[model samples]
Target: MASSTSYPSYKQLKEDFVSNLSGGTVSEIALVCAVAPVVSLLWSTLQARQSFFKPYTTLGFVVDFLLNVGALLLSVTLYSAVPILLNLLLLTAALFIYALPPNLSRKKPRLLPDAKSRAAASAGSLGVLSTKPFLTNYRGNMMVVTCICILAVDFRLFPRRFAKVETWGTSLMDMGVGSFVFSAGVVAARPVLKERADNKYIPLGQRLVKSLRHSLPLLVLGLVRFLSVKGLDYAEHVTEYGVHWNFFFTLGFLPPFVALFQSALRVIPSYAGLAVLLGVVYQIVLESTSLKSYILVGPRTDLISMNREGIFSFFGYLAIFLAGQDTGMIVLPRTLKARKSGSQWTMLLTLAAWSLGWMVLYHLSTTYKYGAGLTVSRRLANLPYILWVVASNTALVSGFGFVDAIFFPAFYNAHDSKTEKEAYEASTSRILRSYNRNGLVIFLLANLLTGLVNMTVPTLDVSPVATMGILVAYMAVVTATAVGLDMYNISIKL
Candidate 1:
């Protein structure tokens, strides 16, 4: 729990950001830039061929494997952090490398058209870009990876604090939760929105019942996880969702409520509208109850009160999820097609504006809350926190859109063209696609590995560099397994 009076000063915040930005080394940047492509290329080749051991693909994997090992050794043996700018530059370069032809003489790769691409073609120019969900799977996989990375390392690994103790501000951990919930929300909302199951023709009670039935798996998983963590005496971080509750509660509880609201109302509200409504209701609850006390201070007797943070925070998380669904509704198309450069830029500008607007609202909400001597509280999942999530995520999605629109023109432009869009996509990021294909399985595997590592190793006591090495190796193992399964078209659907 954070103290209201313990907020960091502005100067401290600036210093921390600077420290974080300056943490990486030149060698680290070059290494990341060099190895990333090979990893992607290997995955792509294996996926495209669907063969375990082809001569060219096997060689690519061998080279990539050696690179991964070398990178790990160098990072642990010699310490240097990769700067944020270098990361950005590397990412941009990688996109260009993947999306564009390397030499004029080389043939352009071909990609099999997906449903999104097909839908975009029918939507026409501007409508095509706006009508479909934009790379939702890729974003979700990124979240899963981010979560795993955070879990793999202890706080001692970082040189600076990522978040202030008292403010519900932008910390890596806060963003992790926000990203996870927002992605999960979109997945939950997909079927309902696509099928029009939320029609008012359905009785509210029936809708609620059906929703609850659908959520049974999440509830069961939540119970099993809680027992596993408690029963196993795994490393417990008090701030990580406390003892009795976890993210599954929010995932399990929110969708049914969303369905109920959709069923009861004559006109379905936009995702943003529902989010605002939930935020207002949450704020009212915060002012009206002793919920804050139990969150920051533990209960004397009742265990449930001690875990009320998760219970209370569910609404704000739900709002974030609903907002994601709305964005999905606008950006995701049943099909996609190539558009003119001008149209793509127009779409990018629209997303940018939405991001900026949400950020301004976040700032205003934070300022208003300060008048009452309260800062943002991630634990509470307050209004400011929800706004921050929407703002940041919208901005992130917009950036990805810019990359996809500008660099990967084939995805949008393949309507009547002879381009090899599918082949190009495969070559560029088979690893990411594979991970996305079985994101849930990978996430579950990461969790299982996290617990196993915690039990076997002293994560907090380990040297920071060694921790980084371990994390890299762990991620490699996870990625290899995911890519391997995806090559065989084996998805563990749960």
Candidate 2:
């Protein structure tokens, strides 16, 4: 299928944004939000018959529509101290590095035969006992640091509810985007996976064909979502209280999109150019008309939500994910290997910037508007808001790079090989091998845990100290549980 829809040029996109006397027209609208891509994936998955049931699978989804309403009601009954909840998160982040072990490296007692204790002795060099355990420990440390950012910084750092302004609780949304960032990081490290791709090699053409051949779910799902949503206008059932089972729709197209990007960028020297073009076009949609007001900022003053094409948060994430893939291609070379490190605390502190920044941003501004005063569009996020995420991304680099340093010890030495075998690792060859194992499952668990905790917690009623204590306790409990399960070898496949 041709993806050539004549998407806008970077210049055209900029011109469109500037042409707006008052943010332009909504007629050129495209994507919507996170759910939009999810819907697309869900549709594709169903059509592919990859899933057995009729896709009503998210837990507490059906059972909790009523519960959502109950929580909505709780808002009225409870005397909320929502700000305190946020402060607690910030406080936990401030203290996180201290609670963690001080040493920066992952070392273990060598269970070896003859000269096995030396870290320098590669399995081949010293005749066998692999260094994977020490490497896994190192990756695990980085993983914990990143998870700290996930649980304490992004996960817990934001107000739960805002009364008058759509952007008042912007930090919470920032945390949500963190999930996407972390997920993308895991995807980029596909070389670290335990799976041996050489043995399972399927040509790119065949892979694409297989992917398309399995896209029946996408067709059915998109059609069903389009029909149920557009034709019947059942959005009342879909707004926070409802579930559309849409991830199936988006997943169908996203992988193909990623693989396609990998192939296209291999030849094209302008993937960044492509991203800039897409980003500018999307920026036009953000600044123009009431488009943002409806799809991203909410209340849907018009029927414009029906126009889910190339103009919303969905487009933003796809563009960003593509950008991420391009980045991964540049960074993840074939010959990666693990290293030992002793700087865990430093990495954790650097990542802590995200939390501190969010705390400061939230304390200073209550909204997500991008420009100066009176801006109501959350979609038109302010310079600081955008900058905040940039800073967060910067913080993440310290964490991810720290991990890469250890697990990808041979990172600097890698070169693309014909078989990609020297470049890649597994049992026959695998790299660091301790990247995110069950990403989606972890995402679900994090989101679910956030929901369950928020559901039971008191509103502004809790003191700042008390709230901070609770947030830390909750995050620790949730993270440790996930880590424990991972340690025990029970999780969704990587």
Candidate 3:
């Protein structure tokens, strides 16, 4: 286990902050908070309202350009205080927009759903609210935004010191991307899973064929990116897993494992059950043998360490995905009852309690076993990390759900209670929608561009300010191009 590091003193923190600001760290943070959030939130709102793909008006683009320019200036100039304030401002704006009532001028007044009807139907028992699997766009949008943010920092566009391995509340890039893939798999499988019966018969050969067919595209992208980066001979860093293992390798492998297990199991196990079983088995095997040493340092271990984290950890990733599937099963029910505010509050509180409990359990278990605080190892992706990821994700979902519940009436203001249902098939967030439509293209584009930037520009030799500017510009171009392509209904999928 990694030893704990001390928190920095106020004087040290101030010095670090000043140094970072002078070196242009604020610009990256500013871009993440200001530009990324705006894109994410605006696109999500437009998606919810089915107003995306409306031609980009000259006035709208002009306003957006000005806003981004102003945000950049504030970041570069103020450096310290402004970024924090701007983040708060962005959070406020997001909440305001979320809580904003429907356009009453253009639409008729819509009332909140009658909680009394639901409550009476329950006959004094706690009413069951069958919610959609995940809160749809919010989780996916957040994942993309986070991936962008993590990449921004990881590529040295942000201060390199911020990537320090020991920082408190650090979200490692590997882990972030891994979690995103796990969530994506879970969400993607929902359509098939919704109707999958426990007794359904499926030949193993058919499952393998299906898995391979689905995995082939991902495999091609993985090989392309791997060869391209190595072929170009870009600067390579240790990155924990060394140079060969990447997320693509993990992506390429997970589908087959998922297919094999799903085809073999009678019914999918519960999230909690799978997590415990996988984690315990992994830890036991790891503890009982020298597999760790073999994978990490023994001769010619490259084949087994496909994710650069060792082979066992892939099992943990699969478990995480399965947990996500369980989450879908719990939330995505056809017989959804409109929930009252009180019931919604109770649900939110329940989720918070679960997160808190898991957090405490994670810390206690790790401390008892290892005599150290739980370290989230992307390399191993052990028990504590799984618990942490699940808890954090649930907390995020519940918090978003709570907010929507608080403003339920506003969300329903466009139609009557009967008509105001979750729009399962309606998402028009150009940024996220485009990314979703062409996941491989976007990922490959980012990698290809990163390689190009490294080769063409003296990235490591540049000032922090220049680096931030380059990264923001690069990301803006990628995302904007995606949005534009999506506007034309173009998806470059395999």
**TM-score, one value per model:** 0.73, 0.45, 0.70
Task: Order the numbered candidates by lDDT, best leading.
Answer: 1, 3, 2
Residues 1-494 of candidate 2: C-alpha lDDT, one tens digit per residue: 97867887533442232221222111111111111122222222221222212232343222222121222112111312332333343335324533444442322244455543342344223211122222232233233333323323221222232211233223323333533543353344353222233445445786577557545655565555556544533212132211332433444455555555545544655444444455556656555766655554355344434433222444444554444443333333322332123333333454455446533543343344643222322233333333333334433343344433433333233222211222223111111132244444444454455435434653234565565555556545544465456557776542
Off by over 4 Å in 1: 1-82, 88-101, 105-141, 163-169, 196-210, 264-268, 298-300, 334-346, 368-374, 416-424
Worst 10 residues of 1 by lDDT: 18-27
Worst 10 residues of 2 by lDDT: 24-33
lDDT of 1 by residue, 114-134 (tens): 855775465443322222213
Report the Cα lDDT for residue 157, model 2.
24
The deviation in Å at residue 278 for candidate 1 is 1.0
Task: State the lDDT at 475 in candidate 2.
Answer: 42
Where does candidate 3 clash, by residue pair?
133-332
Give me the displacement of residue 474 in model 2, in angstroms: 3.1
Which one is best on lDDT?
Answer: 1
C-alpha lDDT score of every prediction, in listed order:
0.57, 0.36, 0.52
Tell me the deviation in Å of residue 173 in model 3: 1.7
lDDT by residue (405-453, candidate 3, tens digit) is 4433333222223333323223223345555556566666767676666
- For model 2 the TM-score comes to 0.45
- List candidate 2 stretches off by more than 4 Å: 1-172, 175-179, 189-253, 285-311, 334-391, 399-435, 453-473
